[model samples]
Target: MMKEIEFTLNGTRTRTETQPGERLLDLLRERLGLTGTKEGCGIGSCGACTVILDGKAVNACLVPAQAVDGRELVTIEGIMQNESLHPIQDALIRHHAIQCGFCTPGLVMSAKALLDENPDPSRGEIQRAIAGNLCRCTGYEQVIEAIQDAAKGGKTQC
Candidate 1:
């Protein structure tokens, strides 16, 4: 059965039909052509498919397409505006946290979710927020630093 779902996607209202049990990942990548949400693991173990759902980071692969109806969803493609990168994205690049870029989107979404909820999160909090996201490169030190920089607007943190 095909069900119609309407939700806010990347700040735009989107209406589309979704098959029952269809993964949100497929809907974004295949149906909507939003490929920033990667699918590293089909299951929820990997956060490569992370997206901000109603201001919280969630695994798109684990979320049902119909479940997003009437909800707000933000993918990597949605975060930027006027062809400029979001602060988090810019920070990641400046910190050299993005190497292969496969996991960058997920990490960015996770960090955005955390910062949205708590603008001044501690270093440990940043770690916990991105714990689900696994990056084979960068060893997380730079990623953490990047998130911290974005959180503090590049100010010196005590």
Candidate 2:
């Protein structure tokens, strides 16, 4: 059965009719047309479907659409403000953190979630924050460096 769900998506309040068993990833991409959130392993092992849900990073593919009825979600599309990229995005560009760009969105969301809660996280903490995410290209060094640079105001690390 399809039910109406209301939630904050990408900083905007949205309402959509979703089936009972539909994954949040489907809802975000198919229903809302937010393709920035990718689906790699669909079973939640690959963090390609990561998103920030109410201040926590979670695998969108693992969450039921019904579960997001009243929560706040931040996707890659929502990371920009006033036509400007988020600090995380800027850092990624500055440090060449992206190679294939398939996992960039998820990685960025996860890093943003981490920095949102703890602006000055240690290298270990940053790694832990993005442990769930899988990056086929860039080998994670650049991603880690980009995130660290963002947290330290572009100085490369804290």
Candidate 3:
């Protein structure tokens, strides 16, 4: 059976019908057409399906679609504003932090969540924030640098 779900998606109010056990990643990619959230590990060990759920970074693959009802969700597709990329995204590109791009979205979301809570996070904090996200390429040095650069601005609205 499909149940009605209402939530805020990408800053807009949204309503949809989803099966009780449907994963949030499936709902975003299949139903809503937000494909930036990837599915590297169905078991949630990989952070490719990360998204901001109620201001925290979470693996969408591990979250039930119905569980997001009445909550605020932000995906990689929603991080930009008025044709401009988020600072974290721009920093990633400038720092060459994205390699192959498979894990960029999740890493970006994780960094965004950290910056949102603590604009000035230490290197260790940044590492811990994205520990769940595994990236075979880039080795995380560039990713960590980008997050640090984004923090210098002290803005994490996106």
> lDDT of each prediction vs. the true structure?
0.92, 0.91, 0.93
TM-score of each: 0.95, 0.95, 0.95
Instruction: Give a tens-digit lDDT track for model 2, residues 3-89.
Output: 999999988899999998899999989998999999999988879989989989999999999999999988888989689999999
In model 3, state the lDDT of residue 104.
93
Please identify model 2 stretches exceeding 4 Å from their true place: 155-158
Q: Rank the candidates by lDDT, best first.
A: 3, 1, 2
Residue 45 lDDT in model 3?
A: 93
Quality of model 3 by C-alpha lDDT: 0.93
Output the lDDT of residue 3, model 3.
94
List, residue by residue over 1-158, the lDDT tens digit for candidate 3.
Answer: 89999999999999999998789999999999999999998898989999999999999999999999999999999999799999999888888888799999999999999999999999999999999999998889988888998888624332
TM-score of 3: 0.95
Model 1 Cα lDDT, one tens digit per residue, 37-144: 999988988799999998889999999999999999999998886889898888888888888999999999999999999999999999999999999977799999
Better of 1 and 2 by lDDT: 1
Question: Candidate 1 at residue 153, lDDT?
Answer: 88
